[model samples]
Target: MNNPHQNARMTPLGRAEMVRRIVEEQRPVAEAAAGFGISRRTARKWLARWRAEGAVGP
Candidate 1:
């Protein structure tokens, strides 16, 4: 599978936005990942980072 993280190069704020839209706003991670053109695993990693730093990681 293609690595979205390697291609997108999303910043910390962009990653945080994706995670918040999925986890906090009750959106689907798969759907969000699709929108962002990233893998679910990448999305989940950003979510974990957000949880760890309270919205400050990439």
Candidate 2:
């Protein structure tokens, strides 16, 4: 399986945007995680961070 985001480096802003797409845009976490080449657990982590601390969360 060739996944572009698998080894790609993303900026914090970029990661925030991805989180926005999932949260604000109502995108499915599993689908977004697959597109990002990350596990669903990671996607949830990001979402949790975003929810707890807005955009600049770690």
Local distance difference test values of all predictions, in order: 0.76, 0.74
lDDT of 1 by residue, 1-58 (tens): 1234665667666776798788778999899888888899989888777777775554
Candidate 2: stretches off by over 4 Å: 1-9
> Where is model 1 more than 4 Å wrong at Cα?
1-8
lDDT of 2 by residue, 1-58 (tens): 1233565555566677778789788999998778777788878887888788876662
Q: What's model 2's overall lDDT?
A: 0.74
TM-score of each: 0.73, 0.73
Q: What local lDDT does model 2 show for residue 46? A: 78
RMSD to the true structure for each prediction, in A, is 5.2, 6.4
Q: How much is the lDDT of residue 6 in candidate 2? A: 62
State which candidate has the highest lDDT: 1
How many steric overlaps does candidate 2 have?
A: 0
lDDT of candidate 1 at residue 35, scale 0 to 100 = 82
Clashing pairs in model 1? none
On TM-score, the leading prediction is: 2
